[model samples]
Target: MVYIIIHLHGRYFIMKQGLFHCEIGMADKLAMVVFSGTVDRLMPVGIIASGAVAMGLDVEVFLTFWGLNSFRKESLTSNTKMSRDYEDMAPMMMQLMKTKNVPSWFDTLKKAKEIGNVRIHACAMTYDLMNMKKEDLADIVDDVMAVGEFVDIAKDAKFTLFI
Candidate 1:
């Protein structure tokens, strides 16, 4: 089989005229396991994903449980929940962010997707447990994936972080 190497942005992706597209070569991956629903934890997911993509790495974010909840279309914009460790400070911090004109976590992640190869996968198990359909999730979510499938992708990541 013959393949052509295309450099889009910073990553090199292999493509063939009549075959499925897959990434190969110098393109590293940054995998993230986002398990937290709170804004405090979610913020880093977006920031880190953005940074990784800017540096020419593919980002695979697996959203499970609470993290998946935060991606629901209904709550994506309205969420104000904070981590338990800073529960009491949530109000003040939220207000501060608003005053400082800081973008919401969802917005940050959305921008990252626009700028680079960032794939956001919703957990299929979590979706079933939460009784959610594909439409229930925000548009930024690429598709539903099983943990095993996600593991297959994450196993070879240059580095993986749980947030």
Candidate 2:
């Protein structure tokens, strides 16, 4: 006896007698465009990247504008402000996070990088515009890259998010 099985998308099939199995494909790469400098927006970027890493997915983060600003060595530790639209909730949110023992976004990203494949790229335009050097940014930043390069890297990603 012989059996054949084929799966599509998320569906799977199993056949007896002659063992055959198929499974759906999952996105192996996660591309993130981090454009915001605020803690509120940055937190999710880290959390999501961490989640992706946990699921065995590669993560690429392209930091531009305010996002690159937030990763500066001088700003990472001192930045506590949320988005302007949520300014009023900053204090409360901070308090809640502290109460819950939530780690900083940078810490989360670092942990993800340590355990999995996570690449952090700083925008070349932002680097030039701000007159910043590689030394001026956090150690987590893998390299400084042009938007075109980053776009090429992200174009093949199975999932992409802008934050």
Candidate 3:
């Protein structure tokens, strides 16, 4: 039989299975590198992080370049433009989302954080290059981190995505 023990919040629980021993703890981690700033591209990043968090995965988002710009407090709420390749469809898509009562991508990410472990990091280099201060970023950002530091965190993630 397999035996398993899990400790949480100072409590311990045990389980038995067939011929194996296991220790259960934190779920897998998911890392995402968000580079695109367009609404359409940014939408998927939030949605995917929501899904991962819902499935018990910890999510870390590294925002750089245009992605970092999109997270600026002033831009987060007012921006609605999509990728240039689909610029013609932006209006239609925005209308459809409004008609369907879809939540904004930033709101979605915020909700995910409320329900699970979701960390958002802004690239230090991008922050400096753009002459932006940490206060310029949305409150959702957990910290400003160097690329090397982020890479170290992401290197062992169960899965990594570039969006």
Off by over 4 Å in 3: 1-25
Per lDDT, the best of the predicted structures is 1
lDDT of 1 by residue, 10-126 (tens): 456888986648767657899999999999999999899899989988999999999999999999878999988899999999999999999999999999999989999999999
User: Ten consecutive residues with minimal summed lDDT in candidate 1?
Assistant: 18-27
What lDDT does each candidate get?
A: 0.91, 0.88, 0.88
- Residue 12 error, candidate 1, Å: 5.1
Q: Candidate 1 has what TM-score?
A: 0.87
Candidate 2 structure quality by residue, lDDT tens digits, 29-106? 899999999999999988998999999888999999999999999998799979898999999999999999999999
Candidate 2 segments exceeding 4 Å error: 1-27
Give per-model TM-scores.
Answer: 0.87, 0.82, 0.84
Q: CA shift at 57, candidate 3, in angstroms?
A: 0.4
Colliding residue pairs in candidate 2: none
